[model samples]
Target chain A: MQPNKITGIGLLTAAGVGCEENYCNFTARNSGICKVTRFELPTAKVKTDFAGLIKSLPNEALPPELLQMLNSDDLAQDYVKAAVYVTAEAIKDAGAAEKISSDPRRTGLIVASSLGNFLNVSELVKDYFMKELYKITSLIHGMNSYLPSRLGSMFGVAGPCYFVSSSCTSALNAILQADTLIKSGIVDRMLVCAVDVCLETGTFHLWNKIRVLSHRNESPQTACRPYCKTRDGIVVSEAAGCFVIERADAVGARGHATIRGIGMANGASDFLKPSPELLEAAIREALALAQTPSDKIDFIAGSASGSPHCDHMESEAICRIFGARAREIPLFPYKSFLGSTFGTQALSEGAFAIKTMNDNLVPEPLNIFERDERVAANAYYKAADYSSYHINNTLFVNYGFAGNHMAVVLEKC
Target chain B: MSKPKITREELIEKIVAAIKKVSGISIAPEKYGDNLFALGLDSIKAIQVVNMLEDELDLMIDDAHLPKFTSINAIAAHFDSLNK
Candidate 1:
């Protein structure tokens, strides 16, 4: 069913601190991945060197009390605080905050993350080494350590404060949930946040074991090479993204960003394997929701993580769904610079694509030297001046671990 | 007399390496008896350690007994005692 359109979206990512900066970087085709400096890693298979780390915060830039909560020692707490702050920004951007504040009961929050405050938990766990494990309070908060409750408490959002953790699909699923709530008239407005922080050990070793991490120790800047034949694997990164979604009428009354449509589906394949059928289904669902034909979708923002298996499945899916038009539709893969921050990557990239649509141009994919022939035969990939194109319609696609696929359609409003 | 089979010191070195590989923590051999949970090793990492040990020493420790075998010393001793 069609829900209310998203009226406003605010984002903080590695490309920049907010929507404006992220757009600027995207338009310029700037890469955010760089040598890791947050922590030390000596024995990593790939250098613990590259990531799309968010270096700034909105509260700090805007100077607000909300920023203080985010700056707390607890990283998970900081993520919630950041989510609330960004939601407020989106509301203000939508011009619906005063109305939302008036009827707090009508508002809700859905935050998603794969690795919440893992760094904070690691520190606390380290602290327990010095103290007694049993002595640690039951309320000890760390990375995903009860982020949903914390977000609810901070924002005074009373309805449906929940966290969705579907690995990389977490954020997109959160958005899907928010859309459902708004369409069902369960809430007038919903704030969706996706946040994650770097954990030193478990996270690091997991990737090392899989050997899907980039080992370009010398050139961290170019480490993430999505869609490139030489692409080794994805670099892990961290950031928090949030947006405020409300009914089109509500947003029209306040003049916020408009949401055209959102679609989600799961692959029936093995949890770790990608499935073309599911990917096509997700794209079709999004197109159906947008009520726009495939030809109208000017560009496709891909969830290409540079894995051979994932790229193959996604390429096949695009070819199947769009047919000849797929070749004409410009394809963009932004994850090479952003690194896959679990599920939040999709939310942030989707937001970027929406902004690009607003600008009437499609953002270029970074570090892609060659396009898959299947996709190339069905899609276009190259650096072109966005100004020359009319990106009235765009599709944002993301895939998550365990075969979760999501697609969202955006149109110039 | 037969050499004291796999002395505590020898076991500590093996445990430390395995833990480092699985949990990504670098701890001294002297710290083997320390509670791993308190040291930030989660359930996932604990499982990794058990798997590593099983592969290294050919032991088939049951998953049900993981919690009781929290420390490196505990895991090593549990394996050692089983063979004894």
Candidate 2:
């Protein structure tokens, strides 16, 4: 099978918007997290009222149908608009937007969103019980596949259109699906976009009730202390990261970054908390599929989302695989820079890694500080100026609830 | 191609206004027979039209009857028949 490559990318995160802008903000180490001011919550006792809230939605930059949804009062409507905007941007970046999705029969659309417009669904349920009102559109909009289906209609992608909700690993799993399709000769092109805006009152209210969210809401700036021993909890962010992946031969000389190998495995023993052994196996699986050695990998994208439970286990996993060399290979953890964008953070990390590798610069990460001793030894030394390294392959690993794990190896083309 | 009947003229007017309010499209009365789908009305926008009609006419439309709201003339005739 021909190798698959990321020809185009479109991103809307707390980091920034669009391909160039998102990459620029990443390299500049700009923090996208801020105080939540869009809507007020009366459920008052929460520690921090701040988050990586995206206030600037480019409605004018989107297509008409998507723009209509974005302007609506329902928070869930933004899902459709965000997906379209990023997907369009990715297609444009690949230099395919002018004649994008032209072959409906050859392209597939898949989005990974867990809540699937939870705010609107909550509002609809409330409307039904309180006011005895039932709307047909509400019934359809409540489905998880509804948002991606809108994208399927908008882009005329006649191939399979679906949604994947595997907790934090959702987006990476979606990418794995696209890779499978391309390698198995199912489709030539795939448009994969992951969008989640659950920061809506209903969802975040529940998260606050559970107290898993960072209590650092007061200071959105340092709320997310990623990969550090002082880390407390994760900060939830709203974003949509998109990419148009195509067979490398199709793009030929125009290739952006090659997707070398992808690996996904379930927990062997533990049901919830992470297993360092399982994570190590996942990384080894990816390297095996990519036909690359551990020593050959230049850097590793650590999946430290301010969750110490994840950090310790993942650190052990790295040590198990790389041994003494684990301390030498630079590790770039994600959450410190953009909070935790749930499953879609996988795509954002992929985008950031691609840009940094292309520019041959490892820009300092925001909110990323002194790492716990285990990761400190292997940490990518944060520098003010771009430092040169023999970077070729980068590994991206993301863990989900229920011990689901995914590791993707991205190689510079 | 035939002209709309004089009796259904008022219902047609309200239906046109309702479509405009729901979908933001201002169509001339001559396009009364045109397909709503052809006029850029999606399932969501079409459902929005149903909602506005229910509020304006003070009648609850059956879920099964929603498909009849295809064009200005169709909606007017459907409401007229329901009024019988």
Name the top TM-score candidate: 2
lDDT of 1 by residue, A131-224 (tens): 6554243235653536676666666777778778887888888888888888888898888888775546556756654445677767766777
Q: List the lowest-lDDT window of 10 residues for candidate 2 chain A.
A: A67-76
Question: What tens digits encode model 2's per-residue C-alpha lDDT throughout B53-84?
Answer: 65566555554455577778888888777655
iRMS per model, in Å, is 10.5, 18.8
Task: Look at candidate 2 and tell me the lDDT of residue A313.
Answer: 80
Worst lDDT 10-window in candidate 1 chain B: B58-67
Question: What digit string (tens of lDDT, one per residue) describes model 2 on residues A121-193?
Answer: 8878988999889777788877888877877777778888898888778888899899888777777888889
lDDT of 1 by residue, B1-84 (tens): 433366666666777888888768998767777898787676556767766766566555644455587888888888777545
Clashes of each: 13, 1
lDDT for each candidate structure:
0.69, 0.74
Reference contacts recovered by each candidate, as fractions?
0.00, 0.00
Q: Largest DockQ belongs to which candidate?
A: 1
Off by over 4 Å in 1: A44-48, A56-63, A67-78, A133-145, A253-257, A267-269, A377-380, B1-84
TM-scores for all predictions: 0.77, 0.78
